[model samples]
Target chain A: MEFSKPIKISRRHVLKMGVMGSAALSLGIFRSQLVKSKTGSAAGSVAAQKTEQIGFMYDQQKCVACRVCQAACKATNNWEEGTEWRRVLTSDKSKAYLSISCNHCEKPACVEVCPVGAYTKREKDGIVIHDAEKCIGCKYCMYACPYHAPQFSDDTGRISKCHFCYERQDNGEDPACVANCPTNALTYGKLAELREAQGGVDQLEGLPNPELTKPSWVIIPKKE
Target chain B: MHWHWMIIIYLFLGGLGAGAYLTSFAAEKGWLGRNSSLRRTGYFIAAPIVAIGTVLLVFDLGQGLTKPWLLIGLLANLSSVMTWGVYILAAFIIVGLLKGYFTLTNKSAPNILTLSGAVLALATGTYTGLLLAVIKAVPFWATWIMPVLFVASALSTGLSLTALLAPLVEKKSFCEGREGRAHILLIVVELIIVAAFVGIMISGVNGPVAKESVALVISGVYALVFWGYFIGLGLLFPLVVYIYRYQRSKVPVIQYVSESPSATSDLAANEQKGHHSYLTIVSDISVIIGGFALRALVILAAIPVWDGITIL
Candidate 1:
């Protein structure tokens, strides 16, 4: 009868119990915040938003190597001479006229490599913007961009690239390059709408041989 | 004068400084327990140098204000060497400070923290080479051994600087003992590594890019600096001095905690305190200067010359 009962708690037992209790409390708080924040943000955004298409489509065959778009971009951005944000590249394969510019990628390499967090992606419109003041001119982003979108200005030692004319877009105006294109090769619209209206890459004619860099450019091949 | 060039230089300098500091720190705390003062000085100087180097990089970016956050927010990108480099540099700065404090206080830093910091420093130091090497666009920089070469260069430069400064920081007598021996050993390793690195670069003559890079380094615009500074003065001169001293039947007399004060005083009194020979000082300075030149040249030479060449 005297040896009937014993109660014992070790340090390890106490520590384990404490850890589990704290973890449970943290998990509960985290779960509640996650649910609450998700719905509130979603509801606020859904009320006034209009779906608009804003993306680029290039017709390689139609490009005449005039580089009007490149000139228009420089004028719009006020870029220094000899520093073209958009460039025209010619290779041996087919007398190809390709305008190399920022693709505004879904998974942008520049954003990933920027050491100074100067680049941001817009959630609503998928526009990638760079703040020059935040740039460290490390050129890491320059190397990361597959399209060679980011251009480093030797004068300022910062990366400069196409901003997609956010000022014009906000005012409901098209980007200068799109406005100035004579051949209508560079078209900007909502990505979803553009995807729906255009034929797939296969439907387009006179396209160059596909390379591995899966450029986001929606190309419409011209009939030969 | 491309901004990319500046960034690359910054990376090289930061990595070299961080690597040297970490290696010296390890040598100080490890079983060698020699040249603690020299190691301490190396770590202290490296932290500031790295900080400045990073600042130069950011300033060159033209958005220095946002640069810090960029480094902090996107600190993890395992696929990119540049991302890893940022984290490594950050860790090195923090750990280098703590380790310096511990050394001064005669306290032991947490084992985990020290080891992790060292590993990070090593990775950061070596990754600079990997960054260049991985860029297939620059055929000269695309070798696997580039990283090792970078690490070796960093070590040599950092140690040489440490040896040069130790006498100035502490009593000349303090540097004369076991610490000097460790410095000698490190110099030996550095020379061997430098030789191997140079050999590899030369052997790549079959590849035009590699051949061009080597030519740029050896007989081109940078030939004099490369040969006169890095090879003859930085590496060879130091090696010869180390060998001569090692052979002269003079082992450095280190101070031990167990030695009696009277005995230590007597030894100190009897010992003829020697200045780091003028040649050693010259060699050290030459190596540091040469190291910087080598890094700058590597960055410039690694870029493909044909990148922007247009055919008529």
Candidate 2:
């Protein structure tokens, strides 16, 4: 049997497709704007005004891998043995060291995947915190986090991670890690200001994609 | 990532129990032919198997035993896959027990009840896979194929468990009839799906972690279990046994077309009595072993995306 020719598209068909595509694109844009405006109304505006998304700023150019941040985090949280809330992973290919803890993400996976609502991102500051009292310790959050931020402790049978030193921040003090960093590599501030100050480069070598959780972090890449 | 053997056994049992319930439901609905022993055995074992798995799951949790009330928190997050699993598992266990009860009491269960239970069984089966797939951190488990492969494995393993228990349930030869054919088809499909799963992941689309995961299973640490136990014993062994039995016990075409219905049935019964022998039992056990190995290997070989990176 002979094969049939492929279906042909004429000028009229092309014009029709173009018109339909343009209409759909315009409708989508209009709908997005409408939704945005609706969500930005009085109550939303007020909520927005009351909140500032907190973020971390790290300068890889200055970190000496001394792990003072890690030590400070451990001391601040008083975490059990075998739990490192903040870890410094050195790059194999380079001398760069990434001192990381929970990014306190805008799209925090821990908040989304914690079955018992153990983890919550505060509306006022976007600081993600874990309530150990509510944790069932299923550890789904550990697997959900692209950054592997949530630490599971067999000793406590619960999950915990960087709380961004919320208590200290509320008391008008820098986080223990930030305050303890001798090189002034670690800092904290409103995410927008941090991004603006750090040139908006949140991702570094050995770090996960910033887009995954929209992590409230900014990093200054190490000089090669 | 510390899921270990407890989660492996839990996932296997959950899928197996769901699969067995489905297999029995299919039999009861006459989709796999009338085998009262098969139906009863499936109903009897499904709920208890799932219940045991649930217990293991709970026990694996940090405070599952000391503060069991904390389990109520599992229902708090509608977005969490584990929350969905809690609901599915609860409904499945309830309906599963009810079905078993009706079967034991010799009462005909309402079609609605059986149908919903079957649907729940399916959900339970699919949910086990979906639970892992939804985790974005583990690139290997993030694919849609995980659920498909899991469903296939669950069905095959469920059928294997039912077949393994059928003879003991009735103290007769577990006749390798239509069930054998179905088993062969399921195994083949499972093999294909496994291949596709490995192929897609290794093709480098999912990410480097996914590729590393495939490497771990294919030729890395888990390669031994993946190839030796899962492929050789679980899939191929049962497949060969079923195919051999099928070839050995082909009823003559003339006998099937016989005018005397009683004679034909008598011959069929006698043939079935000799077919599913002790060899079939061993094959079924191999399948169960393979199922457990499959779950363990998948869990162990999953290299999380953020394990560490070499490049800037």
Candidate 3:
């Protein structure tokens, strides 16, 4: 068989191919930057529109170890026996009192690990909400929550947690626990404002590190 | 949070089923001289063992039996390890059952199906460990070694179980051959992995809670279950029996092959080397018990890094 003559390329053809490759690479880089900026701006706008996070503040110096907040929370949620959403933790070392409920953390592990999507962190106020209807009673959230906030109910076979008293807050009323605190040790407001204005710490001697979940809570540590 | 014995059983059985299927697959591939009995025994047991374990898992769920409809929601979150587990388990169980059926009917399972089943079996075995390892709350469980240890234990126990049952099913001994060697190797590897797993946690690299968990297993609350059941009975006892018997089996091979042996001696020799010998039975049983004890100890000894502010 006869072989075809060898193909030849001039300097112009080589230069044309190189130029075209460079142009294509530059366009690809430019397109990616454009897409990234568009998405970034969209995220920024969404972040700006999000409502301020509501947080709970506890003054350990003022608390008298009263179990009334726990009772009020039970009254508010009407939880069954053996279930307490708010707990009064006392430290024998410092003689301090800590009344803790759900911190409604920024990176809620319960929200991330629930196989059934039963837990959700609210966009409006950053309140971590538990939807009982959607719960599969797997108790995964119970293990996932660092705060031990999600309480399991044997009756309903579902989990419940502090919802920041969102219904009462919507109605411009304090949560039952905060409303009923005789010492006014428990308070609630915008998390950022509370942190700035109060200048208190997010963690105390007995609390889990705030970095785990960035809990929407501020505490006035007890004086030694 | 405490998981009941059902979870422990489920973890134990899941690994066993996967391990058995693997052993059977190896036998089918000519590991045991093309013994259809070994293959059939493994195939028959794998799927049903896993299925029973799965049923216990479902019933253990808070709403599993009362509100069975909620189980469909297990697939809702793809990022959740439990959701991935559901998928892996479902596929493994289906393939296992189909393989078992094919073996029973004396039909050849497709190579693709067989290969997929093997992959799924390994996944199922690994997934059992990964399930606990992902829980960062328990520092003792959240280790890279968790899955590796569980896989080794699964293979060891699964092979022991197949060895225990093969003679009854096939009326012959497979315990004196390469199967014995493989079983011993698996047990040795499992012992090393267990040591590493416990050593890593107790050495304080994982933190105080992890150390506390290890203490609970090694010398504290679950010490008996860990030391007596898992270490002595599950691992060491079986290791001793297999080693002794395997050596004996090797020494007598020449005598058994010679025609000079008397008929009475021949019966005694056959009985000694039989798969259903009292030593083999006891060793296999010990391995099986140890497997259960290991799972139980793992589940019971996990001390969470924190149990919330209320407990503190």
Candidate 4:
């Protein structure tokens, strides 16, 4: 069950927004897009450009609950000693491990709640990026995100979270966690393709329903 | 998880300030009929109180500030709940100041201006609730009735403050009379709304999460606070006091004559005879303290039950 609501653009609204953007900029507003589309478009298009959903696929059965992804993320990102962007959550019985990072959601609450417009879903790709410079460290994003994606960075006193490894992808590499997954349980590809390849879903037994933000990822449940 | 005592404090103060403005506005609109003291007290207290709340929010956000010159994150985004809050709060403060200044100077405030300020106060109260209600994460806060509950609570707390403070500035009659009953009515409504919020959460699709959250208040670690501090002292005691004192005349029948010196002087003379019962003072104090406890209780108990984040 997808928890995130998808954005719909009738082509007219986008054009109207484009016109408004240019008009404002010409008037010396020098402003970035302060408001993002709530009904986030299914395609990862930011502006006029069309983009595909580069999604993550996680398999529960072929896995051991390893902290390698967390380690790799820290090492690769050079995050502070005690700071972590991704975390491992387990059930009370420890029957399974659910690794959580930023969902890079379609209608991200972090972006919506950030007072300074610090979070942006890159138009070229749909990567939900957090610009460190613009962050006011209110932790409102932490409160708003249902999945608790944003982690408070004590070092900087600002909230930090995963950005789908935008830098790595730009450098023609996979995310630190997915690349370092020794079990080969983590997969990354086009979202539509991954859905057909595996019976991927957005909801699970104990996790927050992903239908709220329509997380741009899929998960394979354990075999019955 | 971080303990957001600051947020809780802000919530209480915001409700108090906004609720005062609303109740006062209601009096000014003639909804309460001739309680000028209510209007004056509300106008006087709202600006500074809300200003303090806004400042608290700023410092809370200032946690990550590296440079003092950043001017405290004034940047606004329409999509942000905080951003909307900043605007609404600013509007409230501005209009409140104008209305207050004009009224004090004996300049008549147009109905439009007064109406606008009241509307803004209403927004301020509702937005405070919306901030939490929109957080789909914490199941305890994710309820439809949150906005309504907060508004009612805000009114109750706000009116309670006005009653307590107005006695000191003006005559005790306003606080001791029908306005006191109105304050009680607001509290009663707030209690009912809170029950409805919990009831809906437990009975609806959110039953599982809501039940666990409710347990924290009913039988969990915070049970003592929820029952003792909030429900018992804040709500029940005040209610009993209110019922006992005002059982005879449900509606205060004194005609408000601001220009009638004879009536005003008579009230001042009557004031020396202890016009407001001690229990009324105790009830107002209970409501105020109870209101603060109520915020703290729910917020403290509101730790989301972490079931699991299923990636598979």
Per-candidate interface DockQ score: 0.13, 0.24, 0.20, 0.25
| Residue B53's lDDT in candidate 4 | 85
lDDT of 3 by residue, A42-151 (tens): 54767656757889999988899878998888888988555678999877566778899899888788877887666766666888887777677777666666678888
Q: Report candidate 3's fraction of native contacts.
A: 0.45
User: TM-scores, in order shown?
Assistant: 0.67, 0.87, 0.84, 0.83
DockQ of 3: 0.20
Tens-digit per-residue lDDT, B44-67, candidate 1: 667766777776766664445544
- lDDT, candidate 4, A71-121, per-residue tens: 898888877545568776665464666666777888887888787777888
Q: Please give, for residues B290-309, the per-residue lDDT of candidate 2 as tens digits.
A: 98998998899877787643
Best by DockQ: 4
Best-to-worst ranking by lDDT: 2, 3, 4, 1
lDDT of 3 at B292: 90
Candidate 3, B1-312: lDDT as tens digits? 457799999999999999999988888886643233467677778888999998998888878888886666676666677877777887787778778766775667789978898899899899999988877777888897998988988888888788778777666453333566677888899989999998999789887888998998999988998999999999998888878866765665465676432332334345545456787788888999999999898888877667665323
The docking category that best describes candidate 1 is incorrect
Interface RMSD for candidates 1 onward, in order: 8.6, 10.3, 9.9, 4.6
Between candidates 3 and 4, the DockQ winner? 4
Model 3, runs deviating above 4 Å: A1-48, A197-199, B31-37, B172-176, B252-275, B309-312
Q: How much of the true contact map at the interface does candidate 1 reproduce, as a fraction?
A: 0.21
Query: Model 4, which residues run further than 4 Å from truth?
Result: A1-30, A33-48, A89-95, B1-3, B33-36, B62-75, B171-176, B248-275, B305-312
Ten contiguous residues with the weakest lDDT in model 1 chain A: A203-212
